[model samples]
Target chain A: MARPDQIRFRRSTLGEDVYEALKGLVLEHSLSPGDRINIDALAREFAVSPTPIREALARLEADGLVRKRPLVGYTVSPLLTRAEFDAMFEMRSLLECTSARWAAERADAAHREAVSAEAATTVAPQEDDPDGWHAAFTALDARFHDLVAEASGNGLLRDGIDRLHAHLHLHRRYFPYAQASATVEEHRRIAAAIQAADPDGAEAAMREHLARARERHLAAFD
Target chain B: MARPDQIRFRRSTLGEDVYEALKGLVLEHSLSPGDRINIDALAREFAVSPTPIREALARLEADGLVRKRPLVGYTVSPLLTRAEFDAMFEMRSLLECTSARWAAERADAAHREAVSAEAATTVAPQEDDPDGWHAAFTALDARFHDLVAEASGNGLLRDGIDRLHAHLHLHRRYFPYAQASATVEEHRRIAAAIQAADPDGAEAAMREHLARARERHLAAFD
Candidate 1:
């Protein structure tokens, strides 16, 4: 094991290091939903004192990534219900549609080209490669949405949408590979609309995509 | 001052207690935007050790309520710029509109009555009393929105919207109160639409209300 002080000193910032580490744990499902986290153990594991760990936990708690029982300590927040899943997607549709509309209004040739390139990257020949497709598509999807947010020129909207996107990742692993391909196709359509600079078309395409995604996710629950 | 051990023993869930305390500081403007907070000082002030304070700061930082400088320590996040403010309101308009739509779809007689009564409370004789109206209206606004979220039956959406609402209060205080009566009137219209269970009407009314609110807020920056 690495020396405690060595690890602590090596970290650029105690809070950030702890945050990245814990967020990884949640994403990987090493810490499943509703799992209680022991602060002392986490502190020792990270080779820091309890302070940074506590700080990291507090951040995660507020993000709804974790839940705190007044005296019992922190637990990973539970998986979203069908209703929650629908509502979240409804929100995503609204934001993403708005983003697409703005992107159409604001995207330059370079931004349009960049989004197209991202979409093309997702269409590899390996038809059954779920992992490769998932990894590639995830980055592309993020880039696509980010490009829209950036083009929208709305920092606060971008920030809020980005945060929602992050929390949505909590359930990403549960999505089947087939569903991901459909998302890739949707991205292509959205990018095309932006490239065409048709704000109404882009908004419609993005909303349709989200509606489809919501239906697929709800089906999985059933 | 409270006993150190007494405070520590009063809450072993350091992260949660710290999050609540720090959140209060941010919302109440006890820690204004860009104001630096020393962890050690916070620890002392809370009558707890550095562990909880550090933890709480981490959480606040994540929520965008506080920001950490590499070596300087944490500070309250600054106010949003005009573009950022516009984006926030645009998104708020979208979400709150959706919330109102959902409320209309699901609101019972009791819920409708509650919303009507809350709106009625804001129609005071002192139309110029921003502070008093703010105090009353803010709580009513919260309850109105909370009820909408509850009606939506999505815990995740409710949580996410509530957090955004809290952060928004940070900037709302700066908005001038010259049009307090107009604001109250807008709320009344929104309440009436919701009471009528007209989802489309409620949504349209909310959009108008938010758009007007955004204009009012933006005018302040001029």
Candidate 2:
């Protein structure tokens, strides 16, 4: 059996790898917002043909990380404006609250266990191990939300929630651990409600968590 | 200024035409559900190179009209099953209700006119002119929903609603004019609520319309 790290040996196509690399560049602002992407230049830098780069750019455009013009090539999409951020949250609230309500009623034992485990997990103080803690925190947080969405048993709703969260992640400013405790506690409350099969409670808790999350991120717009 | 028909005379790049043509083929079931799409064959058929076909397939894949695999080629997605139809209606309810509420509060004069114009217009009769009347009904129905979404002024929500409706269209069975009156009257109720700037009324009316629409379409599953 492959070890945890050895899972990387699983063959992914070149296109998938290229897509990830290009997405990283955009998310980390290496390819800064509104920067035009030159297909030939990227091809030279990646030491491959422009085909994969073009494919990746098209996928990224679908993901809302970039935009393409008719005759002109692709450009990194500008950061989410303050107004867009509110719209994003409103969309999230509509989907996730419904997901939580459904998940409470529908989640089977396996999904219930998964959601609980993810919610109970937490990051150590980032002062000692900033990068490791930050990655763990983000992944756990994302997984908890995704698990709830999955447990809702609605593919359309789950896909919408997942994509909106990814879009929200792109707008996040880099930061460490300050609100980690509050966020984790909120997840626990939501998870508890779902596990208890309290549909209204789960929905309300999710709504509260999203409201708080919006408050936490609102400063990034400034 | 160009006439409505003359708008098509404006030049579009090869890729745009290819994309639209391919989308039409899928929606009309000319390319039936689960049919594999061959780039080379499609290029030959369309009298274009394989490059444009590949680009169009990728765009169609993004639109949920087709699926692509790593080594294998693209295939049209299967029709929505009964379960998926339920999920689709659920998602539409969540997004469109929010849109209608916001549109009620936010719609400007132009948007109000557009929504009213679409709702007020109707197909005379399909007994003599089935195809033209069917086309008119579909376009007007779609335009009304889109106008409300646009009037909401929430790009993310609007785009989600638009994409879902297109996805729904792809699954539709060809029929003519039976439910047109009921659907149009429901649309009128929703429009009246929005026109009156009553957010709660608009939301409730949209929700009621969606529930009835779902009931109307449920027999297709059987």
Candidate 3:
């Protein structure tokens, strides 16, 4: 489960940013769920001491990205359970729908333009480069949602959605090209509603998209 | 600014409970906003080594309850800004209103009974024992809201609300006896609606209560 570039820390002389690098590994599933972290091995990987790795792990433990038992050290958190997945989608719908409504009503010119630009970018997976395509596709998808949240003009709502642990790894394995295309269409609908300054329409569109996304994610379990 | 009981770690023989004790200090405002944590002082207070104290601070930083800087160690997070307070209230209204509606629609007999019990509770702050009374009053208020959220059957919604970093300290100092009573009456209205299985009534009551609460908290900034 190890790769040479698994966790490419910037490796500042002062240990400036090991935390973000480590967090990226966990979020991207390079560390893999339920894997016990090997601090010494990671230290060797970066040609640094173990202090920075341990420090990063401590912070990750608090973020619920990792768990620390008395003797077990730390393990990346298990994948989201079915019940957790359902509840999170409920929370997402509640927040994101409101975000869309607010974005439609009050977004500035910049936020509007930015969201539209993000929504308009769409692509299908390449047969020979599926991994590369999936990476670009999901990155764009996350940015689209984040932009809508930013346009909502509510910092708390943005932060709330930001904290929800994203299960992008599930998409890498289970999400098909057809579903990816459908998701882009959903984004375009949401963007159109926002561009029209139609709060009700934006909210309704967001609700529909989230309901469908929930169903799509649930298919992973089946 | 130190209280003998400020940290009050359970002092497990294994040093297992230090993180919780440290988190309590920050949550209760005993550590105070923007106060630089004196790890050595805290270690001495708990009669433990500095290792546990440092460990807990790392976790609190991840929780956004504390901040760390280049040359500086950890400091408790600053109090919420007026904008943050307003945004958080908006989020609270969204989630709590949904929780109330769900409680009305689908709460089992036990959840209904528990919510009714919490809502029926009422009290006024005693002038002679204002601190004592405020403690009991605010605790009950938190419990009442938590019970309704639990009754909603959405663990993610409940968890989102819990992570909002309660500013109960605002209530202790700024909220008065009449306001305390009014808050209880509002709780009763919400509880009664939920008990009666009226989703519209419960949602409306919760929305109204959150609006009033927003106004109450705004008084702190003014």
Candidate 4:
């Protein structure tokens, strides 16, 4: 039999495990947007109590991935409207531009190395593996922005950008990975500017990249 | 005795009630930073189970107020380091300036009215009621910023600013209200610029106000 301490440790991590599981369910569309989450059913499925399930849902709610109403329990947050999309892009322009500039000015050697590594590894994802390619590109894109945010040398700034990116990931999942080649080149420009410690160049490059990304995403609606 | 539906309805709001209670404790410093939050203790204190307490802590963690650890449990997050403070101010400069510009451009009659009302209501808080004065000033300051953020016509932007402000409130509670007169004048400038729909003027005014605020806050460290 497991020791008492061992059992306690396992239980302690149960909430975190449930949080990750629910997040996966939401992102993978196992729990579609606007789908009401049956808390008791989830607890039974996961073989845990309702406490952990409720805790997990609360964290998800804060992520803007889920919604909770009085007496309504939890539901997956609905997809962003076009206006929300525009607002997100506008926010990105303000934040990412500032992040790029700070990354250029404050990035240490490790941060520069991270930027270089991301640039070197990026390539044109294959069309045959659409699902796999999408997942891979999404992760790579996230890493690139994450590295820049970290390099900004501002914890709150990094966290704000991280949360914004987390919200964007949902909308991004539905969009095509078109303009991969163009984005790779754009990344190179951003990387170059950061490496050279050219804050203005870094800011401008990020702005241009986001402007293009907005154009590409807007095409989805049309 | 309450009916079955009424019982269910009461149970539904338990988590929200617990959340507010816990938040008050943290904001009031009844639960000081680094203090361990015993789940069972809270459950017993509130005369409820641990489920709602866990949910409330999860949300607080997302707010960057409470923190969770593996094997251990929840604790109030530590005070912000100088670096963290600088990071927050930098983020505010980017976000608030953009928000002010947008408020100037996009604010309808209702938003303009909110700004005017808040500005008109301002007065130099009396010294004897420092606690009351502080609370009043904080609320008015929050309303001024919130109005600008709402007038930005971007939900995501407003939410981002709101969360950052929530985090800053912890640090700000320690600072004095010495700059109230200067701040009132600054608010006037920002409100006038927004009312006039001068985006550039509003942006510049906000940037200047934040710069001064930053200077005032930095004095706390000296």
Candidate 4: regions farther than 4 A off = A1-12, A123-128, A172-178, B1-12, B123-126
DockQ each candidate and list the results. 0.52, 0.52, 0.44, 0.61
User: How high is each candidate's interface RMSD, in Å?
Assistant: 3.1, 2.0, 3.8, 3.1
The candidates score, on chain A by TM-score, as follows 0.85, 0.88, 0.87, 0.89
The deviation in Å at residue B177 for candidate 4 is 4.0
Clashes of 4: 0
**Candidate 3 ranges beyond 4 A from true positions:** A1-16, A46-51, A165-172, B1-16, B122-124, B165-172
Q: A1-222, model 4: which lDDT tens digit per residue?
A: 566754444655888899998987787667877789999999999999988888889999988999988776788888778888888888888889999999999999889888977866775578798767766777788889889988988777778777777677556356556678787788889999999999999999999999998887777666
Compute each candidate's TM-score over C-alphas: 0.84, 0.91, 0.86, 0.91
User: What is the number of backbone collisions in each predicted candidate, taken in the order shown?
Assistant: 4, 0, 0, 0
Worst 10 contiguous positions by lDDT, candidate 2 chain B? B1-10
What level of docking quality does candidate 2 show? medium
Give the clashing pairs for model 2: none
Tens digits of per-residue lDDT for model 3, A8-37: 553442334677787877877788888898
| Candidate 2 lDDT over residue span B15-118, tens digit each | 67998999888876789888999899999999999877777776777779898877788899988887788889988999999999999999898897788788
Root-mean-square deviation (CA) per prediction = 5.5, 3.6, 6.5, 4.1
TM-score of chain B of each: 0.82, 0.90, 0.86, 0.89
Compare candidates 3 and 4 on TM-score and give the better one. 4
| lDDT digits (tens) for residues B140-185 of candidate 1 | 6677677666665555557657867876766836535567778778
